[model samples]
Target: MPYSRTDLKLEIQTHFDKGFSRDLKILDVGPGAGMYGGLLSEYSDILDYSLGFELDCLEIYPPYIEKFKLKEIYKNVFIGDICTFNISSYDYIILGDVLEHLSIDNAKKVLNTINKNNQKCMVAVPYLSEQGEHEGNIYEAHLQPDLTPEIMKQRYPSLKLLYGNDSYGYYVNYNFNKMKETLVIEYNNLFKKPIKPIYPKNEFKVNFIKGCKFEVIGENKNNYHVEFINQKTNKVIYETDITNNMWTKPSLEYFVDFKIRITDQNNVVWENKFNAENKRVYIHFASNAIGDTLAWFPYAEEFRKKHKCKLIVSTFWNDWFKDTYPNITFVEPGEEQHDLYAMYEVGWHYNEDEDIDYNRIPSNFRKMPLSKTAADQLGLEYREIKPKLSFKKNKSQISGDYVVIAPHASSHAKYWNYKGGWQTVVDYLNDKGYKVVMITKEPMYDDWHDSKLGGTLKGVINKTGNFPLDERANDIMNAKALIGIGSGLSWLSWALGTPVVMISGFSEPYSEFEDCERIYAPKGKCGGCFNKVRLDAGDWEWCPEHKDTDRHFECTTSIKPQVVIDAINRQLEKTP
Candidate 1:
């Protein structure tokens, strides 16, 4: 025992004060001396009901039982073991210092039975030293083969280990003061299973040229038992263990029916099947719509050398024309459509030519090819070409007196409510003698006024909906620092190698792309909404529960404006 009746009474009183129900039907198992029962009676108004069960009846004498009138507060005081008692009738079951007496095997059996019958049970065990003396009956002390808290948790996955205490000298003081004994509850048998570890999904789309060793990502660190089972023979053909994360090139024949089994120290954890087909290059053609055209340019350079075929890229703008490529050729959309080997139409345009060969196209976009009508209008030849080249760029050159706060996103749902707390951040920075620039789309300024944001400070510039895509990129590239909600602009800022402090509300930080200097997200269940997909299909949206509830985005609200400012200053001070 580690806590007295006074402490227990105070704890119960505190629990009630914090809105715990007074009509709690509590069940006490192995109530050693009925001191706990006596304490519950002191607060008759708060504790509406209680039940006590004891194996030994002599512990609670006639005088102690009469003093509290135990039978009046509770339904019954049964004289029997808890293992046979009906447990569902009560709300809570307290098992105080009773588990250490039983052997490991017997205790497991009792725990299993309790788990099967009860919804929740609180368990208390002594934090026994490596060696300790017990003056009681030899059988009353803990057995040598008793299960510890850690071992018990493994056996019972549904159990949730709650609060525990490790205080000494309380037991001696309890005897001297003639007070109730103390014991710590270390484990609670909850009716729910613990959450399992999250495994990354295997939807990675990789484009690799033939004869080159392309790295397959999204594999966990483990012994991957690689096996190629021939579909024709129904037998295994190749077998090897991939010890490292990187996999080298195998024979071209070995690509078919490739099965990978990843195993840990004890058991197989993941299995993947790779289907082989003729490797076709993917060439994406789009208008100069932001940097969508640039995404496919690097990959085209790599595919041309390996395939030894003419790589033709059709675009609206001639930004890539200056860079000479012996193997690669550039053709405008409508200039020469018939001479190209394959065609890649950007955006939502589709083709209706039924006789066109589909196998030559990229696998991801082949299902819906470009329409012949749209291709004729744009004057572009459709060619399927996959660009291959590692892309790296120099860091953004920051040269400016004021820090820019470009918080505009494409969608309203994607926008952070500046009315909520962003205004506080702008005001704080302004008051500290730092200039602030708020850049946004033109339509946003007409709907919202900056006057409410505590009068415009010195050097405060509001350039709304004016800069074009390239100009916006240049503005971010030259800014002292950029801060905004997670959006395409944030990704663009990252691509420019500019330091960014992004406010990620519901989405997970896109770790694959680099750009985020520091990310601020709402804490708790609603924080990481970026990775989650809703049951109903549409564009992703933030948690509606955070919108208008009493809690009111406390997850986001808790993150102060000063915190973001500190993170930005730290990044500026760091050695590059």
Candidate 2:
């Protein structure tokens, strides 16, 4: 039997691993592309010591000789007919398919000339013959008759036959020395499937869902050992009886990839990679905060254009974005189906002990505002992100003409603490003839303690805690300008295209808004502490004890009330 190139390589490694020294001298009569020699070289690298392929070659084809030179597999190249090539002593010699192209008389002469030493040799002759007339070289056509195991033995009686079969031609020892155990392998069944011909130890990729048929010749199709490995976890996920050609690729509902291996009792026959690239892909948006949600909108716009993906997001800010970005097919968080990437792949793991590489996540998101970072990392072109929200004018949220002031934050640290900060601005705006309307949210308000944020003012429309968030949003849209601390309402003010005077020491202006009047304390290292949200950074430091003192608003306490009053005035002067 004619042995496969891989089968020959495996046999060489298995036999040599048992006893051969680290150094070897090999003769290859025809080493096209060095595929066999390359495999042998790689296997030698894996050994504790090196097995140098100090190789000698006998090939007449000029193109292939140059190809071998490029492969760097052979130590010396001798061009001529093997029949007259200078004979040399060698540790191991490979005939490959060289004998098939020579007349039977010449083939026998070369074999006999080489066997004069009883040196180890591997011989292969194709059972089904083909005149592979390569590159217009008529001399390369097969000229010898097919040689069987019985015939091969009869032709060289002095040579000790180690292994021979109809499928793979034969192996022999010239010295007729102590017989070494020979390794045999066959794969006619697998050859039926149109796998790109490969040397040993190369990977093939397959669809995880549409698996493949793996039936070696003569073995029952269902009798091979199969293994499915989860690539994400690097763990064996499945092992059992395979239905031969009927083995369907298993599904990874949560995981998107795996490494699949097929083997018989002796060795691994084949291996392949299986990833979710073939499956449907879904990108999930799970954050509920309005600002955070909209930040990802630009990413969505570019993602839809780049991939045939399903967008799975909540209805939190649906009205503001649904019409702006129509390609997105929104879904409830629980209803999300992940075929490709998912939010959980990048989220902060709750368990600290679990090792996960955040930088390895395949998404565009990072922990920063849109002004500071791109919405996605995968280089998708997206529209520039500026404060954006779509809504119409509603005058009822305010009485008569007015300027809006929204001054509340979720935490006290983000609260502007300059004494009379808002009150001073309110008095100044009132003096400028612009009626001031200070808006506040419910329950968080209720007490009508206007003095707490700044101070209560007469003639200032105190719409404190009265309007729903929707009404407040509309009111912001209608207002000539809005002034507030760094809070959701400040975000709303900018999103609605209304001019805003944002005051906070916790974050820098460049890190938040693209165009706006930013009032921040610049006196301390604590400036822009909002970006340092790490737990160890301590809750966005605020020296509230110095509220009435000069230290208030960190370094920004020096920004007088007139500064903000003038900023609001300038905004009112502009044409929208």
Best by lDDT: 2
Residue 175 displacement in candidate 2 (angstroms): 55
lDDT of 2 at 275: 31
**Predicted structure 2, TM vs. truth:** 0.48
What lDDT tens digits, residue by residue, belong to model 1 across residues 139-209?
A: 34556333455654665455544434442111100111211122112112222233222222222122222
Residue 250 in candidate 2 has what lDDT?
A: 39
lDDT of each: 0.45, 0.57
* Candidate 1 Cα errors over 4 Å, as ranges: 1-282, 285-309, 314-400, 418-420, 431-434, 443-445, 449-459, 534-558, 574-576
Please provide TM-scores, in order, for all candidate models, with all chains considered together: 0.37, 0.48
lDDT for 44 (candidate 1): 32
Report the number of backbone clashes for model 1.
Answer: 29
